[model samples]
Target: MKVYGLTGGIGSGKSTASRMFRELGAEVLDADVIAREVVEPGTPGLAAVAERFPGVLGPDGRLDRTRLGARIFGDPAERAALNGLLHPRIRERFLEQAQALADAGVTRLLYDVPLLIESGLHETMAGVVLVWVPRDVQRERLMHRDGLDAAAAEARLAAQLPLDAKRAHAHWVVDNSGGLESTRAQVRDVWNQLRARD
Candidate 1:
């Protein structure tokens, strides 16, 4: 099985690309989904989080991601602390899932991770496919999607490496600045390329 990293900036339509890949019969492990699972209501992950950052849990005893995000958004030390608490657990789950997929004879696995480059997980993949969008487009899309003001959007983007810089690390770049049909065509082309590798 060949595992590839599928990544992009926050508003670069990475999730959309992941859905297209899933539709095309590729197995995808979404980090964000796994992240949520590791911290679900009754889990130790959630307990550790609630211990470290009190009041982050909602009335339902679920991790209030919005509150936690707001707490750590621009604070490096707080963010690092949170990452330290969750990353190891998340990595363990990722390994378990990847091994299960491999055991099941799955090929062409795509790890849909938004912070693939930042976390340096791309080094473990056969290659990386970046969903690209110009910064202006990315900012506009982010503002509209998240209902964030320009400053907030810019702050979020600043936390990650610019999409343009990440291009140097990508084996393939899927430009997502265009419309859905165009993106689908590019995604299909990339799928063909991945299939060809086999």
Candidate 2:
């Protein structure tokens, strides 16, 4: 199976590219989805998190993700603790899903992970695809998309490896700073190259 790592900065249209890959007949294993799954109510991850970070649960017995994000994003120690707790379980789930897909005869798989570079997961993939945008565009789009101020957007962007740095590490790079049609065209081109094992 060809497992490709797809990553990008926030608001860089990584999700959009992932959907395009699926449309082009690639199985996409999304880390963000797996991360949420591992932390759902009644799960061991949620229980561990609730123990470590009290008051991060909602009245309905579910994890309050926004509150949790606010608590961890500003503190490296807290963020590291959260990642330590969740990343392993998320990896386990990803492996299970990948095995299932491989068993089902899927040849192409894209692992959509936002922090693929920061987490050093690119080494595990057959190739890496970077969906890229300029820092200014990314910050503006993030602020508008997430209802954050400029400073908050900048902080969030600063938390990850820069897009230019990630580009150097990628096997493929898709520029998503333009319109959807352009991005779609780039995705199609990349998909062809991937299928060709380029």
Candidate 3:
């Protein structure tokens, strides 16, 4: 199986491109989805988190994601500490599910990681497809989607690796400036090229 990574910043349309890949018959493993699942109601990951960040739970005993996010986002050391506790577990879960997909003979898989470049996972892919859009567009989209004013949006963007830096390492680059269907067409072209390399 050929495992490729798809990555971009918060509002670069990476998920939209990934959905296009899925429609093209690729097995898509989303890091954010797995991250949430690992810490859900009954998991050991949840237990560990609750142990570290006490009272971060609802009355029904589920992890309060909003509460935890606010706490961690404000404090960098706290964020790193939580990551230390959670990353290993999330990695293990991702591996198990990815292996299952490989075993099922899904040769071309797209692992959509928002922080792939920041986390240095690009080195782990067979190849990488980076989604890119102009910085102004990115900021606007982020502001609209996140309800962040311009300054706050810029701060959020500053947290991750810059789009240009990620673009430098891509095996393929999908520019999302034009339109949704245009982006989808680019993903199709890239998928054909990636699978053909096998």
Q: Write the per-residue lDDT of candidate 1 for residues 170-196, one digit (tens) a residue.
A: 999999999999999999999999989
lDDT of 2 by residue, 1-198 (tens): 889999999989999999998898878999999999999989999999999999999999999999998899879999999999999999999999999999998888999999999899999899999999999999999999999999999999999989999998899999999999999999999999988983
Per-residue C-alpha lDDT of model 3 across residues 1-198, encoded as one tens digit per residue? 777889998899988898888888888999889999988899999999999998899899898988898888858898888988888987898889988988987777888888887777889899889999988999999999989999999988887888999988898999999988899889899988987886
Tell me each candidate's TM-score: 0.97, 0.97, 0.95
Lowest lDDT block of 10, candidate 1: 106-115
Number of residue pairs clashing in candidate 3, backbone atoms closer than 3 angstroms, sequence gap of 3 or more or interchain:
0
Query: What's the candidate order when arranged by decreasing lDDT?
Result: 1, 2, 3
Residue 194 of model 1, lDDT score: 94
Q: What is the C-alpha local distance difference test score of candidate 3?
A: 0.88
Q: Stretches of candidate 3 above 4 Å error?
A: none
Q: State the lDDT at 9 in candidate 1.
A: 93
Candidate 2: segments with Cα more than 4 A from true spot: none
lDDT of each: 0.94, 0.94, 0.88
Each candidate structure's count of clashing pairs: 0, 0, 0
